[model samples]
Target chain A: MKIAFYIFSSLVFVALQTTIFRELTFIGVAPQICLVLVVVAGMLSGKEWGAICGAGMGLLYDIVSGRIVGLNAILFMYIGFFVGVLCKGFFKHKRIVVLFFTAAAELTYSILYYFFAFFIWGQMNIIYVFSKIIVPELLYTTVVAVPIYVLMEKINDYIERKTF
Target chain B: MRYIFEHKIAVLIISLTIVFLVFMASYTSDKARANLGKDGLSTMVLPFQIVFTSVTHNVQDFFAHFGDLEAAGKRIEELETQVAVLENNSRELEDTKLENERLSSLVGIKDSLKSNDSIAAQIIAKDVSNWYTVFTINKGSGDGIADKQAVITTKGLVGYVSEVGAKWAKVTTIINDGTAVGGLVVRTQDVAIVEGEFELQKDLLCKMTYISKGANIVTGDSIETSGLGGIYPKGILIGIIRDVKPETQTVSQNAIIEPAVNFEKVSEVLVLK
Candidate 1:
């Protein structure tokens, strides 16, 4: 059932990202839902489940994006692993960690993305991309972290009812 | 070896290595990327994109029309005051178009154009990442849509087809990175190349480069497709010049543009066949 729920939310979030969220942009930036799921799931479900959910969702997201496959999956797996370890046991009912995890995820993704994608593509404007894309997108994603974290907490609780 | 597999960190590293290898393979192989879209997943999900886009579009339109009615009320009052002058100006403009065509004949450039064949396509999805601008449409080869065909809304030029599937296609807009559209400043008749830059797209703006030094382009001047590129039709509205950027002084000038089409609200487009 947890696996089934994961698949269902993955599809729903991907659909939301490509449609309504496009219009729900702030400062010309939209929240990265896949990244949000990674951070939130890690905080809620602990190391193993969070990493598993992140990998599954990330792969689906990569396919929907139609870009380099598994790029997001790798980032998400590590993000889920680290966040899951960082807040493994003490994270229950702690919502503020959502903001911290999201910030860390955003910063990491931005730097790695700028390095691997933009710089490798011959765009040597790191400072420009850092200031313009990274900062603004971080703020955008952080603002969305609260609502997503709250929702994922409920889903996590539902999944936790049946013991492993 | 058994203990290594039992360690969580070891398992994580193994997963990371596998995904990274797949990523590298897909990055290096064009066939891998093609297989992604052409494979079974996209076909199964295509119907959901259509349905979700339709529902969202309707809800958006419902709210949009409310705003439009309010704006329309104000326009009605303003137009009532200016209706007389606008009627006189319209008559004079029609008369000038006729004389302008006659003069254009001597220059070997016909300012006339016939209607283009087109098909209406519903927007199915927006780009997953905001870093790039790409969208999916419901019509494709079945509707005679092909790569590089221009997509436009009633307001003006939107984008062109970058990729096509049997029943779906991807349209990369001018606001997307690396896209370019040749533009003409209506006020001065000066031609310029409009290109998308990441810095400018942050503000939902594009950069119109290669502006002639002698051209008298000002802020708010309407820019239209120059038709120099055969991809988009001639004289389709591209945008309005917003401001001049002082960078790149060694070459021609560059100006910021606010595209005529409101991309966020665009639900459907007519694709030139």
Candidate 2:
């Protein structure tokens, strides 16, 4: 029952992140609450469950977007696996550290996305993505990180205490 | 690492399962694209898009109402200036009406064009990505809006019906990529093709192509439909030419035009033959 609640809350966060948080784009900075949640899931649920959650989120992202047919799937899955491994040691406490990690994860994802989209897709407009999408998005997402971490932490605590 | 190696079998199986699912889904999507022209994929996706758009619009409306009211004030001031100009023109026309009647009688021409076919429609949804200004209007085949029917604003051309639902229709604006208009320059009597680029800000502008370099095209020339294309009727206003340039060292020229209709604020439209 606790596991079900965690999963459902994560989904709600992801939906809001794409729909509502999406409006908070500041130039290149955009809130990536989904990335933070995926990383947190990997940390808490270990490798197998982390991968499952990553795959589910990736599929949902694909459905909402009109572009990138299977690109999100591969990126999110790999991010989940690595983040899961990275979080094994810090699975409990340390909210500040978790917030830092979330920002780092988002930056890493954005940089990688720029490379794949520019180099692989042969769209040499890296400046447009960096200026219009990436930079401003970074500031917005970083600021949003603190609140998201608090929400995730509260949800985690509520589930563990079985206080539903 | 040791545990991962031991559980390697599960990882391999899961990876294979995902690969297979992706392959199958890709294959199905290819088939879906081929059948898309016949099947109504937009209809299936329309409801979700509408709900999401409405939610976003509500949020934007909350923030933008003040700005809109300010703009309305400025518009009222401009309209008053126009009204003063029209009042002067009406007084001048009052004395010239008999002279105009004598000229028309000599030419043996009708006072105005015939026909009163029109249907009104309200805008339902717009793409928020601002990529395609294609909108759904609350009138379709049932409401006398047929496929490819020309949509117009009080000013001029809006777009044409691209797709139809039971009670709604998707009107693809002239600003959508590759949309071409057979338009005639009002003053020069020269004909040219107007085309759309993917860029939305440029919707207020369209590319007027294939004009002969020798044609005396210039900025501020009014462009209208030439009635060459069966899609739109003759004499419907499109835009005023903002600039004209030679397309190449070749035989054609391209002109930037300011569209008559403000796509961003369209609420209602009329469809006509």
Candidate 3:
């Protein structure tokens, strides 16, 4: 039941990421909601659930929206695991931690993505990508992370109580 | 061995990442088969995506209509005058001689162009990695949509369908770097080549190259598809030249074009089947 619930919820995130979120662009760039979902899932759960949920979400997104089959799958999985480890050491309730975690996840995803997707093709424009796309995305994702974290926390509570 | 066994989940995740990357690399090298998975998944998610796309569009339209209402009144008055003039012109067309020549010319032109068969579709999805601005539309193979078909809005050419599924298809827009279309100056009848670039897209422009030294093209000259490629019909409006850089010894002459179709606001498009 927990597995099914996570899968269902993650698909909703993927659906919204592509459809609704694309329309509500913040200065021509939209927040990567699936990235946020993976991070928030890690924060709310442990590394185990985080990795599982991230892989599922990433694979779904890759198949639906990505050019590469498993690119986002691995990228998001690492983010989920890393978030779980970092938040475990820090005060997860703190706003600064949330900002830092979301920012770090976005940064890591963008770097790995640029390298994997563009660097291989000799299209990596580091200055332009970092300044124009990555930094603005990081800021937007960080701001949006607050509400997402709250939603994840509630979802986590429901999952935990149901399982127990 | 015991240490590795003690942390099974971490080991599993690490292994999974490595495996997925290896497989992804293989798939990238041979992307022809990659569409199998994508087509299946897209078909599965079509209904939900359609619902979300429609719901959001309705909500957006609800808000956009409030702004359009005030302007619509003035537009209606202007259109009313246009109707009167058109009605008078239709009455003038009752003269048989002028009408026959116009009809014959239109029929001759239409015979040369394959522009009649078209299907309308609504955009359902778009993502950020879209240096190509890849998007999915609701109609698909079931609706006779196919790959490499031209997509256009009422204003002008929009893009081409790249992938098709059972109930959905993905479109690669004109702003993507990979797209190349044969175009030329409509006024001077000088042919040129147009291509997409991520850099120029920031300014909402595209690059048009291969202009001859004496082409006499200038800023504000209209560019239209030359129909040499057979992918799109001839004479479809592409854009107007925004900036002209004269030919250098090393580089061909080129111009930056501001596309006639406002890509950002494109909601509905017609796919030439």
- Candidates in order, interface RMSD in Å: 2.5, 6.7, 2.2
TM-score of B-chain for each predicted structure, in order: 0.77, 0.70, 0.84
Which residue segments of model 2 deviate by more than 4 Å? A1-50, A91-122, B1-212, B215-273
Which run of 10 residues does model 3 chain A get worst, by summed lDDT? Answer: A90-99
Full candidate order by TM-score, most accurate first: 3, 1, 2
- Residue-level lDDT tens digits of model 3 in B1-273: 997899988798988888888868767532422266677766666677778888998899899999999999999999999999998888887776467768878777553245468999988877534234778888888898877888988888888877777778778777776688889789999988888876766455789988888788888999988988878888888989999998678346888888988877888899987
Tens-digit per-residue lDDT, B96-206, candidate 1: 988887887778785423457889988889987768888888886767887788899889989888777667777889998788998999989999999998777766789
Q: What's the CA error at residue B118 for candidate 3, in Å?
A: 1.1
The residue pairs found clashing in candidate 1 are: none
How many pairs collide in each candidate, listed in order?
0, 9, 0
- How many clashes does the backbone of model 1 have? 0
TM-scores for every candidate against the unseen true structure: 0.82, 0.60, 0.90
The residue ranges of model 3 lying beyond 4 angstroms of the native Cα positions read A91-95, B1-5, B28-36, B86-115, B128-132, B247-251
* Alpha-carbon deviation at A8 in model 1, angstroms: 1.7
Q: What lDDT is reached at residue A77 by model 1?
A: 76
| Model 1 misplacement above 4 A | A122-132, A159-164, B1-16, B25-39, B43-71, B74-115, B186-189, B245-249
Candidate 3 residue lDDT tens string, A1-164: 76877787787777787788777777667788888888887877768877888888888877776477788889888788878877898764555677788988988898888887777888767887777777777888889988888877787788789889
Candidate 1 TM-score, true structure as reference = 0.82
Global lDDT of each model? 0.79, 0.66, 0.79
- Compute DockQ for each candidate against the true complex: 0.48, 0.17, 0.60
